[model samples]
Target: MNHQSVDVNTAQSFVPKVSVVIPIYNGEADLPDLLSCLLSQTYPKEQVEYLLVDNNSSDRTLSILQTTAENSPITIRPLSENNIQSSYAARNTGIKAATGEIIAFTDADCRPQPQWLNTLIQPFINPEVVIVAGEILALPGTSLLEKFADKQETLSQKHTLAHKFCPYGQTANLAIRQHIFTKSGLFRPYLTTGGDADICWRILKANLGKLEFADDAIVQHRHRVTIKELSSQWRRYGRSNRYLHELHGIELTREIKTKEYIYILLRWLLKEVPKISIQNIIGQASFADLFNTPLGLFTSRERSLGQKKAQLPENAKVIEWF
Candidate 1:
């Protein structure tokens, strides 16, 4: 998907300056590789800059960013947003500090491909595209939980177009025009999760600009390998659902019901059965997918806890693992 290159700033050009913002709490293990990748990006350094905001990390995340800032090709603005314990809050801080018309957001744990920024910013060439959803694939890990995490992300991003109003945009690989913030508003700082959907929904409902999917613009996310980590991740998602629904005036009695268990099992069976390479029933079946159905029960339970917090005036609970 090589789009014709647009000048960084031309009177009638769509290519405008871009600011890539990455929000992290404790990302020492992941930040270096991501920063190195950014330095290798094909996007014009003169037209692009980066903002790595720390949410008061008590780890080496700050030192690493300071070091990376000293060596990165483009200007790297290191900022802080510690008052709120939400990545969305950190992102808003970066948004305020950004000088580019195009603001791209990626997680600190993600290792973006070299062409990532170049590809992501391409759709902006249309001028009408205000929000772009780039592709996210999981970096391989040994654990089945890691594999499950990968599978879940693929499903989550792919099926978003079916959503009636706001097509989903994960911060792992999302780019938005700066003006969208002026019109659609910034990420809800109160939200610890799903603020991406909340803002994109706001934009769509307002008919601000085109929301396009850029499949070639990709990011590789580090999947949660342990059960505890995966459960915590889904719980935030569960809680965010409540917040989003409330904000939209949509109400649901149950987040997960008994009937859903059956549906999930059937859905997994249908999707996995056809691709089996074995003739024997055991060989044809995937135990991991089978286990994922029941795991959904645990994750949904976590979601229930989040929905419970949504009832509180201030949903400030933070998932430490995130």
Candidate 2:
């Protein structure tokens, strides 16, 4: 669907300089830190409008939001019904209500640096640029697992930057023109996972324009601890990949084929099992280095393909694969 272009000058005149939309789930514990960081931004308060969308979180998240709004200069909007619970849905809600020409996005668990907003909006000086993605730094933690997750996230960012075709945005630290959402028809609601990637895919397909990587727009993310948490995260990512496949005619890469995935998993077990059993060995090699990363890529392709396939009805005479 084609998006109606808003007159840049007129929109800018009516709206604030930038509208920062944060979608909150059950994240009461992290609200204070996130708000503190936002309040301390070096950017002028009058130039930026902070909008918080609460996704009907059942915890103290709403109460905290209300209290924080009283002390801070942020606007808090609570959803009437929790019908749509995902972050993507929540963000879409925020976009519809935002008044800024430049719509900035960040997660509730992320704390942006003082220069974050300034850096994120700088690229928008060029009207052609529609999307701006920034760097995500993991906060220091005592747990080794947490530190490992941080390192992995950093590596992922670097890899994402290295790829030109795969240039994407993370909600944790991203900004885009308000018209993009208005024109692009928001994110894919059915995709419970990899919604960020799905949105990026659509943006690129629309030929909306270039996506800029602003390294100076930095935000600190809190890493999840424990292997169980990591595994669950990755699995959900896999399922999301399936959704993507259903929407777009794409599948997993050759590296992420089922056989290769299992092979790498077994290889990691064989290599690390003995080391883990040793008396003095504390750190065993992890298979994530081999399978998980590639698996994610494969899963993304598969999800894209699956999504496309499902969209076609029976006897539709869709193009057949060789």
Q: Over the stretch 1-322, how does candidate 1's per-residue lDDT look in tens digits?
A: 2234456564234457999999999988877687788888887788888999999899988887888788766799889888988898899999989999999999888889998987787778787778888888778776777766665664245755556545767888888988778776677776766677777787888888878788888888777778888767766766667776767754533766668767876776786444452423556555465555556667777777767665524553221111
Give the best candidate by TM-score: 1
Scanning candidate 2 in windows of ten residues, the lowest lDDT window is: 313-322
lDDT digits (tens) for residues 87-127 of candidate 2:
77677777777778888999898989998887777777667
List runs of model 2 lying over 4 Å from the truth.
1-16, 74-81, 154-156, 161-165, 253-322
Query: lDDT winner among the candidates?
Result: 1
Root-mean-square deviation of every model: 5.2, 8.0
Q: After superposition, how far is residue 233 of candidate 2 from its true place, in Å?
A: 1.0
Model 1 weakest lDDT span, ten residues long: 313-322
Against the true structure, candidate 1 reaches a TM-score of 0.82
Error of 2 at 144 (Å): 2.6
- Total colliding residue pairs, candidate 2: 20
